[model samples]
Target chain A: MRNVAVRNLCCGVLLVAVLALAVWAGWVAWERYRAANRPLFHEIGWPDLVPAGWTPPDVLRGMNVNRYQDGDPEAIDALARMKNAWADAPAVKALDGRLVRIAGYVIPLDRENDEVHEFLLLPYFGACIHVPPPPSNQIIYVRSKAPLEGMMTMDTFWVDGTLQVSTTDSPWGQAGYTLQAYDTQHYEVPAQSNKS
Target chain B: MPGILSLALRSAWNRRTTLAFIVAAMVLATILLLSVTQARRSLHESFSQAVNGTDLIVGARGSNVQLLLYAVFHIGDATQNMSWASAQKLARHPAVAWSIPLSLGDSHRGFPVLATSQAYFEHLQVGHGELLQFSQGRMFNDVYDAVIGSEVAQRLGYAVGQRITLTHGAVAMPGAAHADKPFRVVGVLAPTGTPVDRTVHITLAGMEAIHLDWQAGAPLPGMHISAEAARRFDLTPKTITAQLLGLKRRSDVFAMQRAVADEAAEPLMGVLPGVTLDQLWELAGRGEQVLMGLAWVVAVAGIAGMVATLLASLQARRRELAILRAVGAGPWEILALLGLEGLGVTLAGMLLGVLLTASLLPLMSAWLEVHYGISLAGLSLDVTSVTMLALLLAGGVLGSLIPGVCAWRMSLSEGLAPRV
Candidate 1:
């Protein structure tokens, strides 16, 4: 009788403990799934361009973009990632055709002597040039009514325009969003934020 | 309950050294299996990205794999050059967006010299739609000017405004140098993980001018045409190695490829970069699978070692099991205790394996990227790896049953005292 009681006590306690752990894990996972699927209207940054919970999406974070040779599996996955980085970009349909101001580096697409009418706006420098391009959403194709002057590669600019959820394919890179620029200004690093 | 748990812990602590050895073996096996799987997957992924962006690679009719090797990767030599008339006809097609002619034969210190037009840099895309960028200077404009790739400049220690000469063939030997027409380095392209990094770019006209006075493979005897005087004559290339074409629509790729193959001008072929690349990977993937099978065998051996250690220690543990039976412990309880110890060791080993892989991957990946130019994705565990770990744990528990059943039977036969 005592042996049976002891066995029941030990196995019952362990089973309950394991069940508690499993339930906790399931609840946490559910919360995360909800957060990822929630309709969000917050202002986004470069990283936010990729859909929530996507892995291996950041162009510069993990791998060296230039190293994988042709016919290698890694090369194939990287190409698919580049081609379809913005596959689910339209999921955030609320942001389409909305007016938004974004700050980015200018990669001139069509330009004359000292001005540029159309350019790719990137979150960081060297994108679409030396480094593999970021996802489509991270790049914004901007066509300005008036040309911006003294523009060169890696020049930072703050552009105010209507964000249309569209993909533009250019020789430089594919962009998920196209902005019709009404205002443009140079972006300068603030003195306080420089070191802090 | 507490009594049974205490017994299992003390019993495991007695053979801690053997348990440690078993865990170490499992750790090594896990690392090897993971490295091979990750390397093969990443290689195929990176290669597909390079080929998918381009529509068609039009070259001389030969092996599909061979054309991919030279045209896309700049690896081997082209057997024969297609006539310029064939390339021009394909370029002028209404469906073609842009076409860049590639002429490969000469080399500068082992790096292939590609004599193409300005359109090569302007239209050629890498890693999605990324265009080429000049890291140091602009593209070559005049004859006798050269644009070096990032790897070529770094390896040869040549900078813009530096002068370098090309060899007649692809080898870096000291024979048949184009010494009279040394090219001036005008630009250095940024590091592109593609084959472009190891290429030296120049104009097709420049290639024609350098070989103007040459006949067959050697310079014409008793005839010297100065670089300036050679410019007076026609510098058009009569033949080129291949042409890379971009179509207005991707749907036009198959039609254009059919058109190139059925061309009356010359016997030529057009290969879709994506299709040919998949075929090449199919051949290489078989070898990788065989290697992975070997890795699985190593993992199984590690598990066998774990089971052997448990069984070897069972004889010494028989006396302990007999004493517990004398104290009214059930035969089933003996089996449970031994099985629990096995589960404990394997679960700990698996946790350690996860930590070791997470930390080791980032460190090894950095070295791999710098030296081999292969970048591994994030070290976060994938679904396949998680499934493998679960299998390892399950296999470890099943393996533990051998010694568990032995201890159970020994306790039944020898109730108060062990034979040993």
Candidate 2:
């Protein structure tokens, strides 16, 4: 009788302890999942997307970006975390028609055939066709008419315009950063080289 | 306490097989975890270094992802080439610093051929701002000269002056090779652990000359020009697929992007390499989390093994438990002894595992540097790893109590007249 009672107690304790452990693990996993699902960037209303007259501060930090490359679509999961802070962006926008400034390169500049005069803008610095593209560097589609002269080769350009969110996904469309341009202007200014 | 630990070591030495099994488990777990971490680090290093030290990249006005894939990694071919006029206009910006044109349409044995200038080696930066260096020969200067990366050189067994043909598009199966304009190997770059290691770099004129006779990737029926005779045609590339740009003033990147878009030159898009690299990093975070989860599983497995072993050995330790009780050792003392044994075994295994990791790190570093480009010099225990070890030790001790209870019961049953 004593042996049977002891066996029963062992079974009962093991079952309860294991179940408790499982429940605790499940709770931890649930919290982790919840944390992952939470949005990282708080999007302002449409009007708040653009900060009107932002320029390079007294201390300008030059970030290298490859404009010809595309954004990494594999990171579509964390579009929210790519802030100007994390992604060197001016502002994070999940939609289009918002105004923002972007900078990058002009890969294969086409001046003759023009439905839209636009350039591929990178956030950092590089243009290599045979390498994988970075995700934060987005394609800036510009709507312009007149062809400007003397902007040749792979030169960095600052482009200011409104962000037009792409509705459809293209082979080039990836997650993180994407903005089309409207009312775009080019700036070629003398930069104080600190070798940042 | 030192004497007790020495005694414990002696006991472990006596049961070397059992101890060895535990150590083996620990080593395997460590290797698996470490291997995954190394792979993640190297993969990211390779990826980010793919387009490093670049101010901007410009490509076709298609999907940004498509542009990136074809332009940088050479994974796919660009659907179409952008106009040279547009590239020229964007390059002339006053804020412009350095620029390189990349023409991609041809391939050689499934490897994409990049038509670029000699400035590629001088300006191209990768892996924490390291520039490309030639391991074998000099950079390409002539029209028929080519520069290949380290892996390409090794894989193809290509040497200086060895002739090679460029193919059209990414052809895996039998495809047409550009027999007309065979290129001679000029230089081979040392491994940078970047995508450049897989490419064959050539002059832009060579790319144009190779396709002079071929129309739409087919032979122009009997219109063949030998590499010697191909110099008659103007070899200047009409259009390139992509371009890299640097700024005289870094502030002009956005302006250049806008000028290319607004300056009636071309319909294009510019992107930042750093921003996109962060995106890739985010994509790999989940893999990191998954590996960490597996590491936790191994830890749990080790704990369960300790518990099972302690419980299994209780019968053999029954007499010891009775002897302790006879000599005024209480139930708590029995518990403490068994707990100490468990802790000792786990601690030993963990220490040995850590030592092995440290010793093997240099060899691993050498292999990774030569092959995968990961700097594994900092393989010492981090806070998280230390915490894991501590948790394993504590859990092992606590888990032995299950068997310790059995010993307590045995002592109660035997009392002073316990049998060995």
Candidate 3:
């Protein structure tokens, strides 16, 4: 009778131990699944790049830009003023060195074969060809440690990286921000999100 | 289970010859697939490493692709050379940090000659911003001095003090050699695995001096200008094949490209090397895809052969399996026996294939370097290769299961009776 009782006690302990091990294994697996599915970088938008209550210089506030003919002196002067304003555009200092994700169009700089290593990320398409380029604050120079394959000019991508307040000098003038991108994905419309 | 595994092994050993043939086929297929992928990767890496640091290649207004081929790879002739004045103007631009002018169209013993200033040695970068290092001697100082690349020195058996003459064009025709103005080899550069390794370097003055009396690609008759007398005349280069430019700020490249395009004095263009390389790949990527597809077909054929061999043996093994079922073994044991054999054979084949590839790659790498000037990285099992091997493993096991299922059905129906 004592042997039977001892055997039953051992059976109960083994059953409980097995159940506990299964629960612990399930918990670890669930944690891993959550981590794999979670989005890594915080999603941000173009407006986040600009500081609140800051406005662009109104160099051409009253002038009618379209009325002037090509090579008109007044038009040229206005264009120069606009360029100067864009060149000195201020960046949002608070967001410097923040890891964030934003969608932008690519203008490939350094590349190898079909892989792009460095590029300019603009908030809108045709920024290079448009009459007036985007302000310095709107331009984000992105660099990748490993080359991104099959990236082309004007291709939109959701770039995730650490943003910094930096400046790049060009003919039009200085760009205000740069990104050291670790990941870039094709841009897709978020489901059920309101599109402006 | 242990007994079943041993039975499977012994059964496989009974038909070692057939299994060996299947394994050999798998080995050949694996080598082919891996080599194609490796070659494609190395080709891109070699091209990219050749022009790593230069921001732009400015040449005469023409096809960007043509300019890239001529300027970077030295594969073809430049249609026209841009004027020295335009090159100087570009050099003086605020955004231009430095520029190296290149003058081609001369050869020495079938190797193309590159004429540049002292800046080339100081500024030109290769293989990820690595500066050129001389293995022996130094850069040319005298007007008649020459610098040979590593391959040029090794192949021609030249030393630092040897004298060599330039040919007017790429090919060596009779009397085309510039025998009057032989250049002394002042320097020998280390191997860079680029077009540079196949070239002979000289100053722009040396190039001008050698051709001072020549006109329209031929020597002028009755006009013999000695090397000493040639120095008295102007040695300033009037035209250059191309110039490589580096920018003060990388973001200034697009604006600088536009500025070069809009030059009113001369028709000139600037091409981003990386962008142009992408264009070249797009034109040739279809051929690469076809090669990869053929590799896949070969791999699939290998797996199919393994399946066929295992199925053929199943008919012969039916009696063996019935005997096992008769001797206190269950139907599942019969199934496990065949499945284990198929899996074991495939695993052995894969191991041998990997070993063979590892041994063969170094020899292949040397051959490719000597023949094509491509430098391949060492045997690296990157994610893509690992994934391919994994997929092959899955396919192998899945293919072997077919024979296993057949034996299971045969054992269930036969039941200790000889069906064969």
Q: Evaluate every candidate with DockQ and list the scores.
A: 0.02, 0.03, 0.18
lDDT of 1 by residue, B222-330 (tens): 9989878987889999999999998764433444665676576778888866556656867886898899898889879988998999999988777778777766678
Ranking by lDDT: 3, 1, 2
**lDDT tens string, model 2, B66-158?**
676677877655777887777776677555677788888777775668999876778888665678998889998888899998877877798
The numbered model that scores best in DockQ is 3
Q: Is candidate 1 or candidate 2 better by TM-score?
A: 1
Q: Pick by TM-score: which candidate is best?
A: 3
DockQ of candidate 3, scored on C-alphas against the true complex (2 decimals): 0.18
* Every candidate's chain B TM-score: 0.81, 0.81, 0.90
> Distance from true position, residue B293, model 1, in Å?
2.3
* Interface root-mean-square deviation, each candidate: 16.9, 17.0, 8.0
Q: Report the error of model 3 at residue B225, Å.
A: 3.4
**What lDDT is reached at residue B24 by model 1?**
90
Strongest candidate by lDDT = 3
Candidate 3: residue B13 lDDT (0-100)? 85
State the lDDT of candidate 1 residue by residue for A8-56, as single tens digits.
8699999999999999999999999977875433345666555566564
Model 3 chain B: which ten-residue window has the lowest total lDDT?
B370-379
